[model samples]
Target: MSTVVQDRSSAGPLLAKTAIVTGAARRLGSHIALALARHGANVVIHYHRSASQAAQLARQMTQLGVRAWTIQADLADAAQVEALAARSIEASGGVDILINNASFWPEDTIWDMTAQTLQTCMDVHVMAPVILARALARQQREGHIINILDTRVTDYDHKHISYHLAKRTLHTITRILALELAPRVAINAVAPGLILPPDGYGTEYLARLASTNPMNRYGQPEDVVEAVLFLLRSRFITGQVIYVDGGFHMRHQLYV
Candidate 1:
């Protein structure tokens, strides 16, 4: 029931400030891009295969009165990840904010997991963020890097072993990079739970899960978006993972 008090004056032209959001063509990334634009930040939306969707998002951003561009890159490729960072800088003038939201989520039991599946998950969820962060650091630009982590990091689960391991690495980076980036740039994470479920999971499924939480409802994308904005504006905060889970983590079991 807490109201978000956005600083309208601090809304000073993010005019020239640019942000790169990977996997930004749809889902939560799209919401994050729109939220940043609402605060006046120019955005570079990165996509792997959702070309038309990325284009649509860019157009929507323009309508919000901010500059927006779309770039396509397969994050699984190291060279492509490097190029993604480079292109973001080139297209948007200079990357000021980097939201590492691209990830591979596969449903495979530990027994059924393959080496390729594990490696691919690691490449997208762990390595790409590292490469992108390294490239950004080399630019010597004061920036913010927000890695989107899953709420399950605090609690281990074996359902998606590869996905879980890769995301856990991001949590480690959140702390490590916070120290490495130091007084110049800020690095943090927003660990979301049930904001939007994976493909095939519907509202009824979400409601059932939400009923187990103390809040009794699934979180909305705005919840995480607000968390991101808070981290971005709070100069004193960094190296933290703010969970937008509505207390679901406190429950003993998530009744599927």
Candidate 2:
């Protein structure tokens, strides 16, 4: 058996495909949604509370000549997650792609980590993704599922205990589901590092730590977006994680 896979050229463009991108109102998720649309895939933007922004993004995507719909669903709620999947399927016939990018990163440490906080992290990062994957699998469609993870999973972030734990769990789930889903749905993850500032930070903040990575600069959302497109295009690759974090993931902070 040759280790080399079949030709990837046949995957072709994203036309005739519908992609559901969660938390797509803004941030990295928004960029991923736009890229999918630009590549000719109909897009379904999922936003928890950012209705206005989601609608605005939908308009932009439609301008790109791809069908775009904005759907509101609180991914932390299982019922809402189910509704999102159903709505996405209804909006575009069938879903050919699912991007589980909805997540919230709260600044918390061991001292500040409460049970509620931990559960909330898991709800959005773990449960919602799993639920969404279940729905995607049941559809019996040949598609791609990309879970947005963090490079910190390779190391650890003590300051953000719950987020770190949940994302790492998601990374494990990505690999496991890839095997279980098999030849039908290709599951993969893209772990991004310092691509965008966590909620309250500004560009200056990223610039301050720009040289910390081997790339010597901060990464843009487009970097992660392209990695996602690459994974979606590879017909035979699954259960893999692409680090869009420059070289940060390669060098783990053992001291931390």
Which segments of candidate 1 are over 4 A away from where they belong?
Answer: 1-10, 13-15, 252-256
Tens digit of lDDT per residue, candidate 2, span 1-256?
Answer: 2211122235455776889999999988899998887777889999989999999998887767678899998877889989988888887889989999998888899998999989999999999999889888899979899999998898879999999999999999999999999989999999988888777889888899877677878998989988998998898899999988768886755223
Model 2 / residue 191 / CA error / Å? 0.5
TM-score for candidate 2, please give it. Answer: 0.92
Distance from true location, Cα of 157 in model 1, Å: 2.8
> How does model 2 fare in lDDT?
0.87
Which stretch of 10 consecutive residues in model 1 shows the poorest summed lDDT? 1-10
Cα error, candidate 1, residue 153 (Å): 0.6
Runs with alpha carbons beyond 4 Å of true place in candidate 2: 1-11, 253-256
Instruction: Please give each candidate's TM-score.
Output: 0.91, 0.92
- For candidate 1, write residues 14-120 as lDDT tens digits: 44578889999999999998888878788989999999999998887777677888989998899998888888888777788889998888887789999998899
Clash pairs for candidate 1: none
